[model samples]
Target: MNPINKVSQARVMSPILSGLIYAFVIMFAGTLFTSLILLLTSANESNLPAFSYINHIISLLVGGWVAGKKSGTKGWYYGGMLGCIYTLIIFMIAFLSFDAGLNGRSFLLLCVSLLSAGIGGIFGVNSRK
Candidate 1:
């Protein structure tokens, strides 16, 4: 393969990797902020779950958008794949660490993940000039 072609192919392959990195960074920041809020305020512990879902959704959306933008085509597909991969990773971690298993909630999360990322992907693609 031509050196230029190799470099370009590598660049194309990096969108998902970059998206995952960005998603984790965003999630970490959001979690840190949430933790600080919980520590500093009188927020009810019951709200923690809600905040976590919101954080994950937002993180995934942004991640999908980033992947879509980098891929510059089939944004929804790329974004959905990113979201699916992310969800699977999360599920595995929960399964291993918390003894969680596939259930109705897991299905719902998968749906939500796909939808959010798909929407973000559409937006990302359209946003490009």
Candidate 2:
């Protein structure tokens, strides 16, 4: 099947897609945040690392909540999936752009992202009713 046709025929609504949309929105927000940070501090002196980490968590929180709402079941699973996907995208970009290597702290934060998102997911599911 033609990819375009396939997409048109496929289910348009689902937890996964909702999470992706959220992630995209969050990425755009991150870009804007990055611009502001750059303006505020010199590159070498900038707290980009810490700020990005915080931003990522924020994104996961919002995205996870959205995912849970759409999922209707297994909210935490969907949220964790969303966080993992988002993290992978971020890591891939860093690896490609700067040949960055993952370290222990990076792994720890990845787990934290999943946990934070999962918590948000639970909140989302419970808050609805």
Best by TM-score: 1
Clashes of 2: 0
Q: Write the per-residue lDDT of candidate 2 for residues 1-129, one digit (tens) a residue.
A: 645544344546777668768866886799687878788767653567777777777777887888888776788988888778877887898799989889986697789789877876776677677
lDDT of 1 by residue, 28-92 (tens): 99999999999999998899978888888898889888888888888898789888988999899
Error of 1 at 7 (Å): 9.4
Worst 10 residues of 2 by lDDT: 2-11
Best by lDDT: 1
* Residue pairs that clash (backbone atoms under 3 angstroms), model 1: none
Taking the candidates one at a time, how many backbone clashes does each contain?
Answer: 0, 0
Residue 59 accuracy (lDDT) in model 1? 88
lDDT of 2 at 3: 54
Off by over 4 Å in 1: 1-13
Error of 2 at 31 (Å): 3.2
Q: lDDT values of the candidates?
A: 0.84, 0.77
